[model samples]
Target: MSPFNNTTFTHAVFLLTGIPGKEDVYLWITIPFCLVYVISILGNSLILFVIKTDSSLHEPMFIFLSMLAVADLGLSIATIPTILGVFLFNSREIGVNGCFAQLFFIHFSQFTESSVLLFMAFDRLVAISNPLRYTSILTLPRIAIMGLVCVLRGFALILPLPLLLKRYRYCQDNVLSHSYCLHQEVMKLACADITVNNIYGLAISILTMGLDSLLIFISYVMILKTVLSIASREECLKALKTCGSHLCIVLLFYSPEISLSVTHRFMHSSSHLLQIILGYIYMLVPPLMNPIVYSVQSTHLRVRLIRLFVK
Candidate 1:
């Protein structure tokens, strides 16, 4: 019996792929993937716990960091099940509803993370450009609202994707290129024209991540201006030092992301394995590396971590 509902014009199930042509060493591949997942969860959870418990760490910068940690955790959780299932159990079948749910959470967390990074940039700018008013300008309530807005904006943008995708009929085998379902990957299998889906997907990417990237650039530029104008070299160095960790995180998150997006859209002739690898890096690297970067770069965070461990 056909798994797809012909009358409803929707697929009931989709097949997920593990590492292409590397099925024989699925166990070996699982080792690294599992390590990455475990490290991401523990590291991000520690960041959240430390931030929640430490009174001194409740400032705007750490608040934004906590939000980023939550987003990383969400992204990791959204993908880990399917990834582990594919590698550990060889379970590749995902129901249509499950696929859509995963799709929404993955993209929603991505969009929210991007938004958090943008706001963190603004936080840096305010700290360097107007240190005296930083606390006054970014009160706890205001930051909480900003966090809420990030989530709501992501939800509003990504909520329609599954609904839009449901209107099409997938006539071909519903085998996805990656271990998990993605909006673009799912839409590519549809028999009908996906112009609306393509346009909407592209539009949201441009407006959200694209625009956020530009604004982050602008914020740093202004921060640079502010730093350079400081009279004392010591003060200037201090200001730049404050932004160093955030700069590293920005590069970590967006560099591979932009690469993967470009490869997906323009490098159609590229190696399939390369594309899948990029997808894994894009989803996994930020979560895995974020806390490490912060721990090494932020003096306060580093000290707090040391104190937590030493005692």
Candidate 2:
């Protein structure tokens, strides 16, 4: 018997899962997962490097972009180790503390990403509606404060989850759905009354991502109103153009997340395999696509990238 099977409630060791019933294809699956991780890590790193080096990119928009990149990097790094471990070495045992830590970082990064996206929406709103006051309003100190708040908010909100989860007696099944620890998935395995865990987890999700999404939607609506009210067609187009990259990122970041959230909440009869795949998509897609979308959409970033590579 595996040593982890001797798990006790207080010192439980959870077995992380990869694709269910596809153990033989682990090697083949690692290729795409590894590729995505490489791209996300390298891509976000390059974005940070370029933004740091280029003085012209030191505006509020780019500063927020850097925050998003940092969040993506954190999110990617948090999950990739266990994922690769499961796929490459068939290692899936995760201790309770380690699992809790992973769960903390994963959700922390996610919450931070959501906050940063909302901030970016606000940034766009300000840039579009009040162009002259953009720099004045989003000064360096204020931007720094916003970044700090993003970190703090995520830290405060997610720190409680692990503690709450630790209190639960996980004496039943210790097998997790994904190759990494997730709070929702972990909570499901608890044999004790998880009323508080369930409620707290739901509250955190609603307060963080849910609130951010609603605010972002409102910001865009106001942005649209401002754009339509502009007198000159050229000016209106120019204002809307500035928001395109951010809009694409907001969509990319939120779509999979919202879909997965809905699946987990409403679709009780959903396929376990499909839910697992959606979980992967929620974690993988944003980090992988954020940098790509920005690179393709932002002419300035594209030019700098080209110059860095070609020149």
Candidate 3:
């Protein structure tokens, strides 16, 4: 018997209906997307280059920043090309296998990004809470181990995606609603029982992304308490400045993800457009904002970037 016979599969459809009189909207969307992609690439590349070339940036903080940049770049690349393809070619159709592949990379990079942020939070916490032991604690070997853990965590979180897809039965409609494949959206297409998939997905989210966010929040809370306890006002202000940018970036990244998850679970159809917009925002905005946040808030990175570009 065919998979479709054994399982229930929903057809993929474009998430948005074409605008009534706006054939030009395609151009509008594509141009802005391309611009954002280019900037994201350049900005993240500049950070990577600076970290590699500047000996001073060999510390744990910059190492985490570099990895975060790499993750952001991966996240942007995974989603943007497919989105651009949809806008430019009107080809939003994705097969079951293709949908699974997209879902894998998107989730992989997303989880990796979250892992990197968690490491960053820990790095900040160490620097603030135990400055004397920070260096030894966050040693190069430790950083390497953390990096490996992030990679492993990403694969672990995404490994079940294909297996889940394999169990689903697809109907004649294979068009995906969004520009790219989203896990929940694709799961919604399944004709077979999706209780297992949904449960596993939620379990992963709670254990990994959700738990990581909570830990990061706790780290910052302790960090703030430590900073306030410092006797030197100047030192306290300097330390606060160091964390402000990261705090903003973390909030920006997690807030949308939490919102999207809540909306997808409870208010999917009505919030489809909002979901699409937030999806793009989460993927693109973080990378675009990273450069600005680091450069403006961290004098060292800002100086290095300026000097490197000038030379």
Put down candidate 2 lDDT per residue, 35-119, tens digits, no spaces.
Answer: 9999999999999999999999998888999999999999999998789999999998999899999999999999999999999
Residue-by-residue lDDT tens digits, candidate 3, 156-213: 8798977887775665344455677778777776666889889999999999999999
Clashing residue pair totals per candidate (backbone < 3 A): 0, 0, 14
Model 2: lDDT to the true structure: 0.90
lDDT per residue as tens, model 1, 1-311: 45664645443788899898899999998989999999999999999999999999999999999999999999999998789999999999998788888999999999999999999999999988888999999999999999999999999999999989877777767789999989989999888899999999999999999999999999999999989999999999998999998899899889888888888888899999888988998999999999999999998998998898998
Best by lDDT: 1
- The per-residue C-alpha lDDT of model 3 at residue 222 equals 96
Q: TM-score for each prediction?
A: 0.96, 0.96, 0.91
Screening candidate 1 with a backbone cut-off below 3 angstroms (N, C-alpha, C), the clashing residue pairs are none
- The numbered model that scores best in TM-score is 1
**Overall lDDT per candidate, in order of appearance:** 0.92, 0.90, 0.81
- In model 2, the runs with Cα more than 4 Å from the true position are 1-10
- Backbone clash tally (model 1): 0
Q: After best superposition, candidate 1 residue 181: deviation in angstroms?
A: 1.0
